[model samples]
Target: MILRSLFLSTVAAMAPLMAPVSSFAAEPQLKVELSPSSPKQGESMTVIIDPPGNLPPSDASQLTVSFTKSGAALAENYPAFPLDAEGDRYRAIIPTSPLDSHGRTLLQVSDTIETRNLAVWVQKRNFPTQRITLRGSGSGGATQYELDRVAVFKDLVTPIKYWNGIFRAPNSGRVSTIFGVRRYYNGVFANDYYHRGIDYAAGYGSPVVAPAAGKIALIDYEKNGFRVHGNTVGIDHGQGVVSILMHLNSIPTTLKEGDLVQAGQQVGTVGSTGASTGPHLHWGLYVHSVAIDPVPWRNQSVD
Candidate 1:
């Protein structure tokens, strides 16, 4: 006990004379942000990263991010795209609707050096029910719908094209039906007929505009037989982001497949062409094939 006390006293006395033990270097500073930070289910979330001032410009694109939910990795090693010349910052999109695998999803973002476990919140959406009856081209059965979704989901050809500016609203009218609403047809609940797009209660001749720049991927009247989606125009806004304008009375005579359109350009006029109950425009936005809420995308730039 005496020796132990003497040793402690000697060590304390020598501490001032000895150089202090080295400490670890400070961690790098990274500014990470998520927009629509508290996203509801079926919405898209964006992650923006701003690295420390000392980070190299060449390393900007190398700053990859990983996504997780409930401690499980949702996406790993996903490349973050640089938005500007300096390349000190980056951005990536997380289309949460298609992540149906997560029963109770908690979106997260993490890089090799930092983590944001509570990056965003995904809330449950309670939607009201709507009933409709089909006639004419809209009379097709589930077989056609199954086939159409299969087609649209396969349009992964475009490289991710950064949106140049804020997306504009297709129709200037009020929204009649919100996205992801439960549906009933012929007095029976239809599991397959969720309202996958936003509906605008426009008049029969109301004009619809393109929300962003892209080529016309399809102007389908026969693929699914005008019944499921009447006189539809699917715009491929490069990089797997697509926008669909449906229930058109007619596509512009000047507009054709493969034609590049500018944002806010006229695409079609509204009508109850297919199985629609009344004159309205159904505007659907998608990442690949998964439907996402168009609300946030409007007045927002992907760039």
Candidate 2:
């Protein structure tokens, strides 16, 4: 007992002589940059985060982000993934809606230690209204079966990025109806309805090509009860960017799901297979399952 007490007293005497360990180290600062500081409605914006050398532990599992518009919360705890194999660059994409109000949008990015808020200005955009009367528009609205089938492909997000640079027109034709157009069917105002895709008035049996590189994710036919979205082809361009071609007359017998396709590759032919008055192709581009305008994508390249 006496020896133990002597050892304890010796350690206590030496405790004050040892260098103090810091319990409160400064938090690491992350570099956050947005591709377009000001984006218009129906456009996609990317958020990039670069951490310091010593930050983000070896695991670096999940870096999360959230968005708020005019004090209204949108997505919460949305994931941001490493852009490269080395885990240095992290990125996430946010898609703006045509109905979104213009103002400053706030993005909250967080890690284990700290959180940061990024400000982005959203520009105003206007969409025109179109009045149309269909002679035979099927059973009217989309059936539950058709909706369920299309939803699966629209929500798909492949980890790989298959596209680069600007996207091309799926078919050579004049745009009959641009995206985000409010529509009136038979003089009845379509409530909560806006054209989700651009209508290309291409000739019957015209070749329909892929706008960008991707993998064929879905192929549905009109004969299979896809009455609303007949002869549809969906392409997953990775990282939440997807392309959907609807009302195709024919798709090559050899091309199936999981096949890698190059930009401008022929996928099908235009037709009036579903919910259409005449021969036309509807091309819709979605980001994170939200339909956005393809004009910006065609005009500028998003890194």
Candidate 3:
């Protein structure tokens, strides 16, 4: 009886070890969620991904995303970054242009274990036309040098995210021109012209504040060759979100590039410095170098 009892104890101890090796392996678990499931044209979309339990925190770097529209591939594969320090979850922002057709859009999120394809319905948005006549002749377009200076940093992706909540209005004046408005410059229909940013009818020298916390990426003046983007100040709000303040009257002497600024902090004053018909402020918000409507960003916070 003693021997039988000892044998039973030994069998129970060995039972788990004798089971199949596959049982010990971790099961596949990769979940994805989208905010504002049905996105609209000129709006930004956020992709949240929860990696499998077995993947290490560093594996989040390996995650990649590609987009497809109307059976054709869109841009290059975009990388996903860890949203938290633990690396359990990741995030990516997809920017929609004003010209992107409204229809079914497909996105594929892939990892080591499995690849998930997500279908997104993009809603259509109508934009109005605005005709403007410059006081003096010719197009006051930005020079190649000025365009290059601003273009180099627009799509840069910083590792850290500085914004936490909704963005505030930079100036307290009423909006003059909304974004995405087609333009007839001087009565000749300018084929590729659409209002890229919002125009505020702020008086000369009105306080222009930072909409969100960020690092000052650029500060330039008209004398410095910023012909069209007169007296520009660009703040990088990390993770591909950037704010470009153009036609400013002045930027604080103490404020320089790479300086940290808080929301509502005074960075410049409103003015019609660059190609101005009058004194006003032009604020352009960009994601991944693509300018989208700032109204959605002002209404809700991105998680």
Candidate 4:
């Protein structure tokens, strides 16, 4: 009960921070564009908006973005903000769901009075399922999961820094499990269970690198059962973009949180340290705290 209460209070405090800005003038001229033309389930895409430059420099309007189909919201993510002077288009990401339809997606981008809808066609991608007993303590894992969930929600929403281009692969190894597959664990069947990241199979001590320039947000090497990740590190790349490297075989003793790391810098090495079947790097990416497919980010540079 105490934990639940604390969670609710935390959410309440976040409410005001997430409230949409309602101070836009009527009928502001804005246009939205979806890049790649076609995307896939769990893939990352962009939604660019041409903001009106007639407004004063300080007249910042809230650009709200959501991916929905038949009235169900599949994802919500941030794009780069502040329509540049002279009316350049601003970019935001549209991260798709693991279970989204192969075709016919509706993207809603709006400010206050103006709402625009873009029809998107997403290609199909298959995600495999695995049913395994969690090798970590259920209680401790649950606690850390709750804490990380809230912390990620709060941190990823604010993309305070901007780095141009798409992210690179943390490692060149092959993926053991694709993102967004159904996960059936320990006799519990839940429709929402999906692998949030890609697992790269590697030998013990294989190097793991940062995919983009960002500040290290977290480094956990604690031995308590709660450290189910076992030497995990989080990087915040600004613009509400964040990525995490988990289950490292080894973490550098000199590394610390808040250190700025460039793209492709070494963070740790592949390991089977945490509840894993073998040595591998589990890398996950998020926008506004929502998990998205990292494949597209690896393939192309998103503006």
User: lDDT of each prediction vs. the true structure?
Assistant: 0.67, 0.79, 0.81, 0.70
TM-score versus the correct structure, for each prediction: 0.71, 0.83, 0.85, 0.75
Tens-place lDDT per residue, model 1, 238-269, is 76678888879888888888899888888999
Measured by TM-score, the strongest candidate is 3
Error of 1 at 284 (Å): 0.3
Show model 3 residue runs off by greater than 4 Å.
1-28, 54-57, 70-72, 132-139, 185-191
Q: Write the per-residue lDDT of candidate 4 for residues 8-34, one digit (tens) a residue.
A: 445433422332344243443666666
Q: Which pairs clash (backbone N, Cα, C closer than 3 Å) in model 1?
A: 137-227, 138-227, 159-239, 160-239
Q: Could you tell me how far off, in angstroms, the CA of residue 196 lies in candidate 2 after the best superposition? A: 1.1
RMSD of 2: 14.9
What's the ranking of the predictions by TM-score, best on top? Answer: 3, 2, 4, 1
Number of the predicted model whose lDDT against the real structure is largest: 3
The window of 10 residues in a row where model 2 has the poorest summed lDDT is 15-24
Candidate 3 on 70-100: residue-level lDDT in tens? 4456544666777777877898888876677
Give the C-alpha miss distance for residue 233 in model 3, angstroms: 0.3
Better of 1 and 2 by TM-score: 2
Return the lDDT, model 1, position 234. Answer: 83
